[model samples]
Target: MKIFIIGITGRVGSLLARSLQDRGDTVSGLVRRPDQQSALQDAGIVAAVGDLTALTPEGLAELTGDVDALVFTAGAGGGTAEQTTAIDFGGVVTAIAAADLRGIRRFGLVSAFPEAWRERHLGAGFEHYMDMKKHADQALTHSDLDWIILRPAVLLDEAGTGRIALGPAELHGDVPRQDVADTMAELLHEPQITRQILELNHGGTPVAEAVQAAVRR
Candidate 1:
């Protein structure tokens, strides 16, 4: 599979790129800075240097052309509402449009749980983040593509356990960044898991079994 990751420089995004490459997929990323290119290349990921917020749909389509799938893990992180909206919400909108134009049919996004549910647990400081994610998820849901939205709880830096609880709609508790990457990699090849919104956290269900169950359900 030839895959392109939007924020390949991010923690989850970088890890995901490496994970996909380790499994022999040709992976590329849309990077903003030249400095970030070496890191991606070191991990065997092709870097297409460009800013998501600056690219036109035609430019984006050109960059993503011939890729089999796209993984979006970008986030603005504690910036103002406007900044978050531009990168998280606006970036996704552009990528989806580009992917549609380029005929890339599969998309995987790392999103957050519902704002109402998350606010109850994590509390405050997340208004804009949640709002942006909500809109981004909605855009993908309404697009003409096979999409998988993985809403993981607070991401931890701990190593992956190769097991996760993937619920159809909502789940609570922290999940390791590595586990999230692993799960998304699995979903890339899973065309049967189309148009599903799933939540992930540390649990006993094996990743493959959980994904299969989600599709079957």
Candidate 2:
């Protein structure tokens, strides 16, 4: 399968891109800077360079042209609330609209747990982050595409255990970035896993087995 990943240079995004490539899939990464192109190429990913936060629908259509699916992991990364909203919420929304226009139905969104939505954690840095996350997830939830939203708990850079708890149940804990990437790679190949929001953490069944079980739910 041919897949495009937004924010493919980041920790989770880069892992997902490389993991897909390892599985013999054609992986393309959307890079915002010219200097970033070589890194993706080095990892054997086709580099589609453009700023999703500012790209028009036409430009986005061209960038994502002929791709089979899109995985969005873009974020403002501790920037101001406006910038966070622009990239986290606005960027994903634009990509989703562009994907629909291009007739791409498969989308994967990397979002955080909706802790802020449940309890108002106003004024905290985390509150702003979750607010943006809530909107982005909602946009995907209502889109025409076949979407899977993965809400992982505190992201750790530790090595993957190749296992996880994958479901809609209220799972809370830290999850390694690599484990999240593992689940994403499996989700892409499993057509049975569409239109669901699942939480990921470091425990329980093996990643693929957990995914299969989650889809059967």
Best-matching candidate per TM-score: 2
- The CA lDDT of each predicted structure is 0.86, 0.86
| lDDT by residue for model 1 (156-190), tens | 99888988899776557888999999899988878
Candidate 2: tens digits of C-alpha lDDT, residues 130-156 = 878989999999988999999987788
What is the Cα-based TM-score of model 1?
A: 0.93
Candidate 2 contains a number of clashing pairs equal to 0
Native-vs-model 2 lDDT? 0.86
